[model samples]
Target: MIKFLSALIFSLLIPLSASAAEYSDGNGYTTIKTPVRTSDPNKIEVTEIFWYGCPHCYSLEPLVQAWKKDLPSDVDFKYLPAVFGRGWLAHAKAFYVADLLGMEDKIRADLFNAIHVERRNLNSEDALARFFADYGVNEDDFRKQYDSFAVNSRLSQADAKIRAYGARGVPGIIVNGKYLVSAESANGNENIFKVVDFLIEQERQK
Candidate 1:
């Protein structure tokens, strides 16, 4: 009778253990040492490291936007374009130029479509100039900001932050400088924000 009672208790405990296993510390995300300093002390900074040329980053854009709409007021979302090596600095420049011209929101996803959907080679200054011209920005204006000291300063800052964040690839999500979540760690783009939400809550407690 004691053995029979023990078997029943073990079976009951099995389901509880399995359910608790869903949320794990290391399986879905990795913690970083020395949490990166956030610009706003009042808000939790969530940075999405991406490249405009990357299809995966393009695909995740809409989903991320939808998720952004419902984010808690304490969470701040920002983008940091990944500059892995040579040739990527051009798109990084495009990001800042759009910001300087106050057209970042208008051109961000459109640039992605131009690259992956429209199949345009926008990795060059001439091509980017033409692309910006279509949005009513003249070549001189676009080029001026593209090479301006302020824009270059922002690029340098992004480069340093990317290195310090230890980003491995495009579409990496860093939460409050403490956790790094990517498609590889989260299993797919769909779950990246879910892990991000988890990390936000984790930071809130600290």
Candidate 2:
């Protein structure tokens, strides 16, 4: 009887030892990592895959911004616009155009607001040109880059990256090229960042 009890206790403690890291959330949406820590040999890259037309992505933007502001110096954070389908591809083009024109900071959030908040249909180059003109971007220059091979190629690459990430939906995050942190995770979006921080610390320890 004593031996059996000791074996049972050991089995229970084994699982607990593997999941020793803890995270806090005032609400119920918080998750921790599993035992097998996933790591990448390259720099710690944190990429957020989102689409401008996604309301959830829009809602998460502020939280993402906060995270970016407080991100550690060692972390490399990037925003990769996702082209999940025909509807999302246009926004992806706009994102690349902004990137090529060196106007991503000025226009990325506005594009999101235009789609989700303002209910504007910027689904075509003509519409996008009008939108850019309103924002003081020269219409011709915007059109040139919008139709440029560079922008188109980058958009293609973005689409490929989105597919490679196996993103079932928008507003998903990929950490260090391996661990995927999605809202589907037990902790949800808020906990995703916590998991990321934990992973970064784990890497530092190594």
Candidate 3:
């Protein structure tokens, strides 16, 4: 059910388009050593490796949301919380728990807002529980699932994938698992999507 709902939400995130002009090498992204292939050959997978506590990710949130509004239908975007830093795994768990509870889309921006804008301390389980409860999510239920096997499994998979992408920092974007782009490479938040769109076009032609 989780995967199905996630797919449905992804399918509706953006628009549709075809190929584009050539993309120069080393402009804004790096090709992965072993490209991570997508499950659906018909869809180009775009994954963002981010941590909620990351200020850069927070700043890029609005731009990414705006960019996603018009994403080509053949592109599928999903968030992969980077758990490389201290206390990051806990936050990753929160993300999965939110998804499990069907509140990911509802609270994703709010989580970023709470931490960056509202200055809420959601670093720990107790703190996050209270934060989620404010949204009417059952505290007990959230806590239970937060530590469940399913969430843990997803976190484990995320750890492996982040390492595979060779992302030394947060807020990395991987297009079709073949290219990696970040603020440093893209030069700015807004341009990251431009690089992604270019990569998606590159993949579409294949």
Candidate 4:
């Protein structure tokens, strides 16, 4: 009786362990990380490679923001606007322009909303200039930097990184440049963060 009572108490006190299971459909589809990490172990970098026009990415912004806000002090988070096709280049340029202007954090969320909710077409130089003007950016200055060698180079690098990460779609998370977590693993934006936390813990031990 005492052994039985002790076993029951132990089971009640100990939480169930989580299994490392691969969640996927049968169509050669599986969740993968975004922004494939380069060999930079000085920091645990987490990057989300996304496009302004991607509905999945748009839906993920708030969840990613919350995860970033609560991130461990050692973790670094970055947003890389993915330019996977010709249609995405203009938005990528606009993202680089905002980065050059030091307005990335200030305008990133609005950019997402402008494309996803406001139904604004930011996929062109002219439209981007107009959008910036609304936000008080000098059109000439923005135009100068938008097509600058530096911005173009950065956009190219971002493209390469996205491809290297093997991301077939948006709303993906790459942890420490090795593990990827995406909505494909689970059905919700919050699940991505949960996978991120899991990956971080896994990396922490190594």
Task: Tell me the spans in candidate 3 whose CA falls farther than 4 Å from its real position.
Answer: 1-23
Identify the leading candidate in terms of TM-score: 1
- The lDDT-based order of candidates, best leading, equals 1, 3, 4, 2
> How well is each residue in 26-133 modelled by candidate 2, as lDDT tens digits?
222222233222233456778888888888788888888888998887788888888767877778878888877788889878888888879999988889899989
The root-mean-square deviation over C-alpha atoms between each candidate and the true structure, in angstroms, is 3.1, 6.6, 12.6, 3.6
Task: For model 2, state the Cα shift of residue 82 in Å.
Answer: 1.4
lDDT of 4 by residue, 1-206 (tens): 99999999888766533244433322112334443545567668888878888898888888887777787877888888887677888888888899888898888889888988899878888889988998899899889999999999998888787777777677777777666667865556767776677666666777
Model 3 clash tally, residue pairs: 1
Taken over the whole model, the C-alpha lDDT of each candidate is 0.88, 0.74, 0.86, 0.76
lDDT: which is higher, 1 or 2? 1
**Model 2: what TM-score?**
0.78
Task: Report the lDDT of model 4 for residue 88.
Answer: 88
Q: Candidate 2 deviates by what RMSD?
A: 6.6
Q: Among all windows of ten consecutive residues in candidate 2, which has the lowest summed lDDT?
A: 28-37
Best by lDDT: 1
TM-score versus the correct structure, for each prediction: 0.89, 0.78, 0.87, 0.84
Q: CA shift at 93, candidate 4, in angstroms?
A: 0.9
